[model samples]
Structure formats: structure tokens, C-alpha cells
Target: MIAAVRPQADPPPEATRAPEAVLPQDVHATEAVRATEAAHAPGAAPATARRRPMVAHDLDGLPVPRAAYPLTRLPRNEPHASLDGARIVVSGGRGMGDLAAFPILYDIAARLGGAVGASLPAVDAGWAPVTRQVGISGKYVSPDIYLAIGISGTPQHLAGIDPHTRIVAINNDEQANIFNVAEAGVVAEWQVLLPALLNALDHPGDA
Candidate 1:
């Protein structure tokens, strides 16, 4: 039987950096540098017929695959805002209730110096733009902090979030899957909590 396993966090950025052009201890590392030099070298023979070394079915009977980048894109009345490299992402879901919740979400994001994201349902319900959708079919996000409001963590949604990102879930449902993966979670209604949060954000320390 197949078992579910949560993804582990990636190593530190410095540790994940590409290896040096030539590592003294690694003889194979020098090949990349040598090949680069050979590419620009004068009168160097081109490797036109070369293919990857692997064990596979007969190439003679297989069809070649083709791919292409889109040349044209659908235009929109309002320009789409990208969520790439956002430091903080305040995402909402269908559980956020009516359309009024979105303005509050946007306000919160602005106050936090972050971007807004949404689940598929919210996008389809016309509460949020498709550009703001986060999921397997949507844009992948690797933010420092992801604050999920009224979002039930679905595999489709979670797939878009990086393992390194810190998740903070705010949901009324006690059994929400979001809490399973969240670093921290709050069980409360966003309507009640968001207003209070906004008040706190507006006034730092007044009783």
C-alpha cells in the first residue's frame, strides 16, 4: 500500500548553490569547465549526433517529442499582477464567505507588505483573479511566510507552496487539513479576528 509522506525542508541556500567550476577533490567537476571551453574553441568538431547515455527502449521505433513556448497570450482589461518572489502571501479560500472578505484580505496584505493569493474556488467564484490562484494548476509560490485564511489545505493547493515556506493557517474548522502542515494555526472566525487584527495593526498598543 502507498503511504503519504510530508515533504522535508530544503537545505540552506548556500548549501544548495551549484558546485564550483573545478573542485580539487572532484575529478568529474572539471569536465563541465573543459566542455565549456571546447564549445568556443577554434575548429572544434561539433557533437551533432550525440545523445544522453541511458538504457531505454529502441530509439528507431520511438517518436520524437516536440515542445514550444506560447507566442500569444490572452489579454485582460486589468493587467495581471505577478505573485513571484513575494516575501509574504496572504491567501484566502471559499470559506472566507462573501466578496466583502476580499477587500479586507487585500488590506491585510498591503499592511503586511505582502501579496494576495487564493484557492481555485475563490478564483472561480469571481472573488479573486486567476493570476492570484495557488495550486498544482496555478503558480508555485516560495514566499518567506504564507498566511492562509479560511483555507482548507488540499493537495492541489499545497502543491504550489514550497516546502521551505512557513505556513500560518487561520481557519474556523477544527479538523482542517491546513493545520496539519501549518507551522502555526488559529481557530477563529476571520470576520471576528480580521477586524481585531486590523484594529491592532492600526493602533499598536492602545487598550
Candidate 2:
């Protein structure tokens, strides 16, 4: 036998439904919201009470204040030697030997109108000031011409040197790492080379 189908009735409308009973917690929460709204309403008193101005009391037996002292400005020291924007940089390393080599390096730098820089060991040995040191731990430089004197060309030292600069390495050891990166190299001792270079600079035709 075939069964007859019956349609389900639709749910009641929200407007016609009875309102839900408010719980004790919900009643308390509604009262709190109303209280907050009333407290912040226009012409309502401030939530926080006004405080009285505080009076500072001096301690008995305190010492009298001292007179104002005048301060003198400190005299400026010699200007710091910077290599940031130099046209050329003549840098020396430990291979140049002792503090004596620095003056020669400085002279060369001066003649070339360049700045003087130093490697870690030269600075540590007191041959050059800390301000002149160049490496990862020191100043980074990018000059038109970078004249590296007796520098072994460690990765750390090379890190401070710009790759675009024309590197001229002067070292007695032909196999020195500096030669690998140098655009031009001179395999000779600084003692012999420096004097010759200075003399050449003094007399260009003789050079």
C-alpha cells in the first residue's frame, strides 16, 4: 500500500516569541552597565575624586644650598683623521715593521694627498692609532686608489675594503694574499721601496 505525504509546519516568528527570563548574573551585569553609562553621562561628576596640592617640607638640620658654579668649556683636541671619503688610502701592516714605518707611510700618504690607514696588528703594536685601524672591527673605506703596504690581506681586513677600488699591494712576499686581490703589485721590501718612492716623488724625472 502507498503512504500519503504530510508537510511540516513553519517555525513561529521572532517578534511573536516570549522573552527569556534574566538570570541573577545577567541582571547584575545590566545594572553595572547602566551605572557606568550614568557615571560617564553629560554633567556627571568625574569618576576619580580631585586630589589636594602637596606641600613639600624641608628636613630640619639640612645643609644650606651651595652657590651655582660656572663651568668652563673643554678645549678641543686635534681633529680626528678620517678615511671615509678619501681619494686614496695608504694602509700599512705589521710586515712593514715597527713604529718607524708609520712615518714613512704617513709621508707617502701626504705626498699622494691620501689618508693613512693601518691593519689590526699595526694598531695593536702601537705603530698606528686606534682611529687609523681598518678591518671588520675598524673603519670601512672606499677610495679611488687603495695602496696596501705589507698587508697579508686577511678576509677580515679585506671586508673593510671596497671591491670597486683599485688595489695596489706592496709586499716583499710575492705569494702574499694581498697580491691575489691587487690590480697592481710590487714585490719589494718597504725599507728599500719607501726611500725610492719618496725620492721618486721628490724628483719625478729621476723616478
The lDDT for every candidate, in the order shown, is 0.58, 0.57
Instruction: Report the C-alpha lDDT of model 1 over 114-193, residue by residue, as the tens digit.
Output: 88899998999998889999987787898887888989877678778876676777777846767555654455667655
Error of 2 at 48 (Å): 74
Which residue runs of candidate 2 sit more than 4 Å off their true CA positions?
1-81
Error of 1 at 73 (Å): 32
Check candidate 1 and list the clashing pairs. Answer: none
C-alpha lDDT of candidate 1 relative to the true structure: 0.58
For candidate 2, write residues 8-120 as lDDT tens digits: 22211321110111011111100000112223222334333222222222222322221221113221243434687988899999897877667767666777778889999
Name the runs in model 1 displaced over 4 angstroms.
1-81
Q: TM-scores across all candidates?
A: 0.61, 0.60
